[model samples]
Target: MIPTRIAVIQGDPRARVDLAVGALAPRLISRDAARAHIALAAAGMILLGGDDVHVDVSVGAGCLLEIEDVGGTIAYRADGRRSSWTMEVHVAEGATLLWRGLPFVATDGADVERRTTLHLATGATAVIRETLVLGRHGESGGRLASSFVAGDADGPLLVEQLDLDGLAPEPGVLGAHRVLDSVIALGFEPETTRGDLVLEHSGAIARHLGAETHTSRLDRVWDEWVKRARQRTASHVDKPANEAAVGGN
Candidate 1:
């Protein structure tokens, strides 16, 4: 059989809500799901038997938007064969975008590569969080390679690169840990208040993660926060590479 590829693109209208996709279709969250202008679009994207998946997004001027996933995204590890996923985002001035990506979990022994790039214009605000998990609890077979780059109109701002050879452990990377996640949020500069909101609201995020893991409870909620920071190799306040930083993590 063959795999299906999806593309999506979004643009901002007069008041906001301008989002689109290239090939992938999105499931919008119920208006009752959240507050004004905020929308959650997620889909269970499958990597077909013989194809890859790609997603693209754009935000127009004077718009405020938020994108999130319904749940963790599972990736099937291909043996020596390769599979990939890519996301490209563009943000215009006076516009705001919050992209909360779900976790990516690789199957054992599967070979996979994924990349995400974001471009932002001056006065354009955005926050993005990406999480990747090496392997599931007990399953293991293939390899996972991933990279991310974010920049604005001026130059580069943030970059993350990772490579794992096999199901086997990487000394400093994953070590023996099978599951890992990363969250990166940008913007919150002039406002400054948003960063604090994230910290206070992070309790829900921590509790949610605790619920997800279930069995082994973390001694301190703040511990998970630190782990996520290490995985992405970005400070709490740093959004992609294009914008100037404002606060501390």
Candidate 2:
């Protein structure tokens, strides 16, 4: 059996020490470097032709980490085997991470499964976004199974799952076209005025890309709907104990 792999390349600190604070602390990171890191990591994984892929990322406190892929990840048609990608991120307190992975293009007959789990400690902030493009231009194949989970110490903060099978592009699913994207922002609440600004920015992007827009307060979405949903019912109530038994706690 061939082994799966994950590559990580973090940036160096580039902050000056405050005379009062004593030691220098990393404040911000370069987005260019971040994109390059993911690009190289994914490129290496693609070359390996493995049966599975897993990536885990951790950012220490007071460090700013930004990650982006060079371009879309294309998963070719798989044989009988399945390909999987997993990302686990831990953003410590007083840190920021702008982690966004580009659109993943799955060609015909491809069975790719992807999951992302983010753990945000108090005072940490992160903005994460992912886009998926179903089936390439031609030579149609298989569906993409994706799951996203973001949470803190208490429980899940957000969860988005996708099981797009046997479904082509339509008005509701992936819009009139065949591309869909979602974003999540966690940690400190944005001010009312700033909240409006964020919405405006998202609207501009939606208009530019010709994609449908959906935005909600993460808290309200989780409390009113997510917490009461079908999968969520089992997730928050029953899974933690099971996870603890498995040493996942």
Candidate 3:
């Protein structure tokens, strides 16, 4: 397990960071009075059989955190075994989380479980981009079971599960598609919803399932969604009630 934590108070000039690195290394790329940019790099071979990777993220009130992946992740063959990856995120009121993820490829014979859990306070927002690729050059991919859950103090916002184990090519599933790309915005809907499915709650997800990564053509949507999220976070005005009392801290 690789533990990474960062926070910024209402009037703080810098972000406080804590870390205990394992298979992944987290580094602060840049920071300021209102925002922080960080990056995650792979330390060594990962997603092998019996490997369990966990990530925990927290954004303080009135702060903004942006995370970028240095490269992509490739899950190799797991010889009748399995690997797991989990991420848990908490966004405080008036804060925002933006995660820019690269592609994740599962090679032949690979079996992996991926899970994400998100918690958003009132008025908080988050934007995420992810691309899942089935196989490498010329082979059929392995099995992947992915689950996601997101909610706030009021109630549940989103919940979904995708099981590709022996069901990748099913009618409702991938079905001859090797790539599944998505750009998701939570806590608020973006400016556009063209050809995208709107969530039941105050959120939306733009997805593209195609034969190849480039064929998805979701980069433009990602750019627009990210811009919208940035604008919202930049102008958010709410802060904790005690912010005035602890402004000097």
Number of clashing pairs, model 3?
0
Worst 10 residues of 3 by lDDT: 240-249
How far in Å is the alpha carbon of 30 misplaced in model 3?
Answer: 0.5
Task: Give TM per candidate.
Answer: 0.63, 0.60, 0.89
* Candidate 3 lDDT score relative to the true structure: 0.78
Question: For model 1, how does the per-residue alpha-carbon lDDT over 1-249 read when each residue is reduced to its tens digit?
Answer: 122222222321112233343234453331111111223333345542233666666666544445666566666745456777777778666555666666676766566778888777776555565566655665653566788777777676566688875446678776655554444444332122222233321112221221123332322333444343223323211332222121110
For model 3, what is the error of residue 157's alpha carbon versus the real structure, in angstroms, after optimal superposition? 1.1
Best-performing candidate as measured by lDDT: 3
Question: For model 2, which pairs clash?
Answer: 108-140, 108-141, 109-141, 109-142
Model 2 lDDT per residue over 36-90, tens place: 1122223243412244655556655554554555556777767756677666778
**TM-score for candidate 1:** 0.63
Instruction: List CA RMSD, all candidates.
Output: 11.0, 14.3, 5.3
Candidate lDDT (C-alpha), each: 0.49, 0.47, 0.78
Candidate 3, superposed: residue stretches over 4 Å from native = 4-11, 166-168, 235-249
Question: Of the candidates numbered 1 and 2, which has the greater TM-score value?
Answer: 1
Instruction: Write the number of the candidate with greater TM-score, choosing between 1 and 3.
Output: 3
Candidate 2 lDDT trough over 10 residues, lowest sum: 17-26
